[model samples]
Target: MPQTSKIFYQLKPLLQYVPSIEPPEKRVPLQDKLFWTLGCLLVFLVASQTGLYGIRIGDKTPDPWYWFRAVLASNRGTLMELGISPVVTSSLVMQLLIGSRLLHVDYSNKEDSALYTSAQKLCAIVITVGEALAYVVSGKMF
Candidate 1:
């Protein structure tokens, strides 16, 4: 019998073609990596402060899931409102699958690992779109 994640197995060909940033040819120094990491965090913080382009003041919408904001790393109406939420959601799902043994991960095999990561990416995109649509339909965001 096929597992629920069997569909991801079928995506091997397309996943292989997914472009990825190559690793640094030379090892990066810790200080340099730390500097870049901090810089990115600063940028993300600034972005989270910036509100959505179309949102207006005094437009309070019902938010039953406000508690999840911290976990999902998002703000109410900022550019980071959906920040990493999709990725986190998909990752959480994958973790559940792995923990339940519903999805077997053969980390020793390069192809299997690649497929797992690629499948997560695909799932994240879908979840992102779905969440965005739900928010819009709920009149939470215009």
Candidate 2:
């Protein structure tokens, strides 16, 4: 077995508690896949339009994230304000760590791969919560 990063070893105990979707027991048909995809898209669209309650938008305040929001498909003062940022950011961080040799991961090994994935998910969750807290603390939603 190749040498793994200490960080990965330390996180191993917590990985089991991370929520994950199980793979389908059988192969899904194309039509079913399409239906599910569209269903999720519809849900996301609806959620994007659902504004966060009690968020006061100041008219005179210039939107600093106008262009940033456009690129991320996020709606200001909405549930999707965080957008796909947490997932993207976590993936980038993990990739950079592995690429820089800061975190050694053997992708060919099943255990190693699984651990790396769980680590990414954990990172994403932490980032999402951190971002949400920052928004509230900084009064960015106002």
Question: Model-by-model lDDT, in order?
Answer: 0.80, 0.86
Candidate 2 CA-lDDT value = 0.86
The 10-residue segment with the lowest total lDDT in model 2: 54-63
Give TM per candidate: 0.77, 0.89
By TM-score, how accurate is candidate 1? 0.77
Query: Which pairs clash in model 2?
Result: none
After superposition, the stretches of candidate 2 with alpha carbons farther than 4 Å from their true spots are 1-3, 56-61
Candidate 1, residue 37: Cα displacement in angstroms equals 0.8
Ten-residue segment with the worst summed lDDT in candidate 1? 1-10
RMSD of each: 3.2, 2.0
Pick the TM-score winner: 2
